[model samples]
Target: MKYTEEQLASIRHPRGHSVTFAVAGSGKTQMLVGRVAWLLQQGVAAKHIRLLAFNRSARAQLQDRIRVALPMGAEMPRISTFNSLGHRLCELFEREQQLPRHELSTSEALLKKMARRALVDALAAGNEKGPVSAEMLDDFVAFIGLAKADIEPPDVVLRRLPAGNGRAFFCDAFVRFERNRQERRVRFYDDQVRDPVLLMRAEPATAQRVTNKFDVVIVDEFQDVSRVQLELLVILVGTRAQLNVVGDDSQCIYAWRGARPEFMGRRFDTCFPGATRYTLSRTFRFGHQVSLAAAHLIRHNRHRADTLCISAPSTPNTAISLVKAHNTGQQEAVVEAIAAWCRRNGARRQVAVLARLWAQLMALELALLEHAIPYYKPGPALFDLPELAGLLGYCRLAAGTLFAEPRAREVVRAMLTTPTLFLSANALDNLVEQILSAPEQAGRLIADAAPRKAPNWKREPFYLRAELWRAAQHAWTGKGAADALQVYAVQTGLRKALEGDATDATTEKRLAYETLLHLAQASRATVTEFVAHMDRLRASQRDYQAGSDEILLLTTIHQAKGLEWPCVVLTGLEAGAFPGKRAALEEERRLAYVAMTRGRSQLFLVIPPDAHFQANMEGRPPPLHGKPSVAVSPFLYEACLPASIELGAVLHQCRPEDVGAVRLPAAPASNQALLQRYLRAVASSAESSGAT
Candidate 1:
């Protein structure tokens, strides 16, 4: 709870208009709370102080902090999001201005569905060719959302688009979506800000009336605020009100969601030219190496202000590491590293594995579950998805079941429902009984039971599902298990059964299946072993330690932003995977900066060792060259740390006999060159000294 000199200076800023550049792990919330308490002591009324947050979660965090920062029964300050406060402004004069208050449509889940529907309809009507892709739908939705925030009509939005029918297609979708909104008279997220901006601009008296309601405004996470949201604050601060905003420009990774970081780096300073600026660069969360690593990576970005700073050095001496491994071995290596971190610290769980794409996370999830490491995923648990379950069932069914295995029954239940067999459960149960009763001749029993096939099996009187299941069972080991899974997919009408209405969610389901196959190949885990692993996980699902607060967290880098853990691991650090195919290099570099900073004590960057190896990036778009081939990401090189090989080797008492042993690549060898040397030595040493 100790405040640094920089933090204390930022906390006591005399207010007019001010911006605090709180770098990563700089305890932004504490500084903001400290300043608010300072303001209250300076006679600023709590009722007159408006503390705005970027989102509901942040608003709640602020509310919690305020309670702790102030004494019991202290006057509570006004706290809300920018949109909520703006919406209230419009509401204040709704009746006087004859403005109709549209009911806010706040459910993102429902809106995504409706938005997809509108885009599909528009694309179909416009004679657009091709399957309606998730990217196309997302692009259309982003356009509509941005257009509304800019208060631009469909035509204005069209002129701003890149040269393609996408402009027209997106515009068409926007018009259709706006019409739907009008018909329903429901306010979307953008409308909450857009309507108020329009209201205030059209009527200065209304703006003044709203501004008169508050004397001081403090906003957190201002880096992610869009242009319109900034405009609302500018209007409210018009000459009279005091403004104080704290955010990290380096952490501005939400550009895809329409957040404008320019507002944080440049626009805010221009809008309030005389604003008192403070840079709280002393990061209290991490030590020297973490600070230096984040600094090196983030400095490459074109935007972002403030120099990275470290609080104090400590034991476990915070370090950034680069791991070179094969596609399969990478997962295993990460698991071992995490287990070792926990063991060394004598800790339970304060670790996270963050990646840009879900593919990496999915692969790690399997590895973690197999080892029984208690971890919490933020969104949908991939293993719990029906698509995965169905595919798992196919493998389990093909692998066959014995009388003693309870998992076989679960597999049967999943198989029956996932793909309809056009037969009663009793019939399927009898077939399973036959297979179980006659283990050696189960194939013969199935073949005898199957009816003769017509020239066109599709037109056969009997459903071919059972016969297909039998055919899948013929090859049920190793790669053959994965092969059988594909057979089941094709025979079962995978698109019809698993893909629902061609939505993006189904796209994820499809990709998830691909990840499952990847997991199968990497682990070479038998169906029985897979089931047993899952059974152990489920059995301990309610165990106290398993349910304890975030032992191991697996999430995307975007979700990992604004969160910190004692140890953090960033997976898929290969060229295409980390920078990503669609996003800009600078943005991706910023992502790397954000990712590395999340670790308070340790940071590990896991990359596939060779170009031939594909680090699991299934769900995302392929790199332009085709499939992503492994290459050293520039961000990794930016960190300037020695390959962890020497340190690790030293720790295991297996140092390379000489540095000369590292094979220099034909062209400019990197850390991977050193890792190759280390791995070769480790393999040899493990056979003798029993060191891993």
Candidate 2:
């Protein structure tokens, strides 16, 4: 891993406050690691150097890289996520001040629920000016989160409440939330960062003492740093410690999560006067064709820096395709075509499918699964599975003492009618109806409705029902929700029932159970908190599986960041889909740029042939009754690339003369206009010669 000249310059830049604008796939992490090694070689102690990463995975990678860079017996620098660093600072402050430790709420959803209820109560008392809706509640909560990240005070938030109907309600709720948090000595996850900043501001001596502990501070992914995070860095560095920040502004896509890419621009120089700026523009991940396409697409963004540094061209006329599929059958046909291409090129593990949204990938996922394609979604957590909904519902019911609520009734009904339960449907329905009718006596009714013995080799449903009831009672008394769920799962033999068949369903259920066990081992929450966490997990549609790297990847463009594949399939490249009707045009263009850049050697952009063509459902094709109205994304035209072709003409048994002629958009008269035209001619020649 020899360093490029640009990377070496970034690593060895005069040591003061500096910012590095690292482009996508430009070895940012490698350069950062090199800089840390340089600092160590300059006599900076490992203990005095701190590195911050955006996530645990990134932190782990940094740690590994630093270890490799250091001598065999040398010590490693402190590397951690911002949240972890904040937690460490808070703990040290608490110990020094002799203050009691306060429990932090791990679940943001729990805090949101509390805030929503407070707003509802305030609105009921006529404190609000207009009607309150769920969307309003969600928006108010998000606003508060962002405000805290920006270090805004309650009065400032009240003054800036977006001039909406729930303004008064949001203000009231915000004030009440502050008061309640102070009273209970409870903090939200954001407070891990916020409280430390407050503590440092109120105690300059403490802040100075902490600053003395670090000689250099390096922040990765600085483009996504929120205002408060920047403030924390400033306080910690204290004009003495060397500060090095690295990130790419064009890759900053987390605006919804309080990220402010502007901070990575001129604000860096403002924060640290005379700070040097460096750019790592050379990308080693993709070839010239992919780079040119990405460069042209991102040229539309007004805020980005100059064009990316291009590498020398290789394999002249890179393989790029534009496929048109009309219906579900055609969509499946496209998948089959991809499979054929994979087999011919031996690129099964090097391919990925990137979509604009998760919903759009559902049908593709199903089609791949039906075709026995090995696919992997990196983080499909157990809680996101519909199969585990019943189990989670039962856990919630177990945590609640009363069984009269509608939620409790629904959980019981689902449990009784579960396929693994082997209970008669009519009997379960009658039992549920009785319990619903007599809400107050729901517990007694459930116990009485338990069926007798079933003529099977295994234990009966009656015994399982009794075990579940006992587990619920125990959970209500003292045991946590996680504990109760574990007990119920074991006693009911759910894992055994799900494991008998060696099929995909069995594999999924077993993996889900393993995830549940992992959760149980990690959780320290009480029953109520556990239930709330579970609720939050259910609301979030993240999923995870082991060995994901060995399968085909299907994910959103957002998730596709920081990743690359040899062959990439960009799906749903139509108007109102890729640009997305509600998204900012520049941001959407950046997204398209990101998707295009992920491909190393080959890229395929899939387009619907007609307005009626949709891939929204499983096994359902586009309606067969409409004229062709769907057009390729404006981005394809905007890129001015000429490698596009219809998929129908390029399938496995197709003749070279059947290749659909590509309609190249007129090249824009920008810096790359001439290059685009030259590339178009090359692609035209290649296509006519039957080159993929």
Candidate 3:
């Protein structure tokens, strides 16, 4: 954990303002922690320091690091994500101005819905440029978010829009969407920065008060900050507080989300005059092979700083390998390779399978399942689980009915017949049909059809029905969804019913309940708003923790950032798959760089012989008219050539069935041994060339 000279300089740089161009795996977080400690040593009060991270998880990590670095009794600085900070600011502003307190909806789904409604209204008014489908509405909503991030005015956005029939329609829809937000007194996540920046500009005294709230501000992942976010930071610092921004421009992969990497470069200098710049190039995550390959790959980017000064690892091994397979069967080979490595190294928890997209992991997941390999997929949030869907649905129905605005009856029928109730499928279907057939007498019919037997009392479907009805009644009495769920679970032994005997299942059910309770506690709103929030989250498709640590990780490269594995497998290394047909080449290269650098001691890039055919045909062999093969990505060539290696000749080629027989060669036992072997190989190669 010794700090490098560059890292120390970054930590102790002049205090007015500064920017750190920290490369990936360069221990940026460590330096940030060190900077906090250094500031404390220089008589800065921890309570006056503000550290902003990109996400809650990162913020928590920073908080942990800061606490560990400080003396036990030292006060910790305020650390939060930008949105959390905005929420705090909003609260303060509301109290000061006596404005109506409102809730912030960070759900993109809700924003999309609002935008869609506005577009439809515009179309109804005979606007020829209106969006015609839900997909188009989604795109327009995303564009609006990006525009706001860029701090672009509506006229600027209109001018930049492609000359299309929908330009006028979109402009009107955007204005209507803003007006709707004002009427609802709600704020989205982006407005956390947007509104605060607006307020600061409008009220100089308030801005001064805000700036005085902090003595220093440190922002992580500064490369991904949008223009409005930068503006907010500038306003909050306001030539008084020391400002420190840390990020790597080469790692700016969120351009589609309106991240302007240039802000971390020249724009930062312009905003904070006399700001010192520092770069941390020494990486401690990956070994020499990974560092070399990543440096080579990212240097191809058109906009980047100087070449990274990659420090060679003391225990550098032959960590990089190219594995070639024939077709879809290669997934099994990949699984076998993983199993073999796990057996030899006993580090399954430190291994991962990273792909470009989530869909690409389907075959790998199936293979891992077949092999009985423990794996985690980052499932949906607790409320979105299929097992809990019934509970959520029932709560929503009850809440909706209280307002006299229930959803479709079919939805109600589905909720009543959910598999979690353990009702006989045929009987439930019959009951639903009867209910649909006789809507007026549905309640009476349900009571009449309810089973009367109690032989297996707890397991009886009648008992489940009664419990759900009871929960619904409680919900109707104004109990929140979380409370109602807890009541139902306890009253009917629902947890025991769902858990059965499996320990993992029992643990998952318990965690789901705990998660529900936590969500309920965090939301201070009414039952209806809570239910609506849960519904919107379910619709958003965001991944949540699977609550298991002893499992192999399967995730996209994007999700694998800030994480490292001892053994890493990069799948689908073909042109169309890795680079993707629609993505910019530079972005794809950065992705490859990120993937390569994730490995600490081992890196395997798998290239299927028919990659093109598999990608085109969805992991199946080519159809009758499909192309026969795929070319290896140019990145592979770029990395392999300069490393003085003939990848194709040296790579181990095997079929799915032969994977068990293809073993990795034993590496040198010690760093000195490995360095000696490398030197000998170089000398021998030179001798052979001289003889030729």
Cα RMSD, each candidate: 11.2, 14.4, 15.9
Candidate number achieving the greatest TM-score relative to the actual structure: 1
Residue 65 Cα positional deviation in candidate 1, in Å, after optimal superposition: 3.1
TM-score of each: 0.72, 0.66, 0.65
> Per-residue CA lDDT of candidate 3, range 369-425, in tens?
445566766633233343345555556656754223243444544455433433443
lDDT (tens digit, per residue) of candidate 2 on 1-692: 56766677889977788888887777788899889888888888888888898889989988897888788989888888989888877788778863347777787777876776667667767643333443355667776777677676755655543343436556667777767777778877777788888777776776876664578899998988887888888887886688998988777776545675578876676787777888876666655556556666777778766646343222223366666753122356568767876887775778888876654454455455445566766544333443454555566655663364345665666555332544333556677778657744555655565443424343355556655665565545456656766766676676666555433234334434544444555566656666666655433322323334456777889898888887888886766456765456776787788888787667887776644333211124556675556556778766645422221112212333432343333333473453544344334322211111
lDDT of 2 at 350: 80
Name every residue pair that clashes in candidate 3.
129-166
lDDT of 2: 0.64
Q: Which candidate model has the greater TM-score, 2 or 3?
A: 2
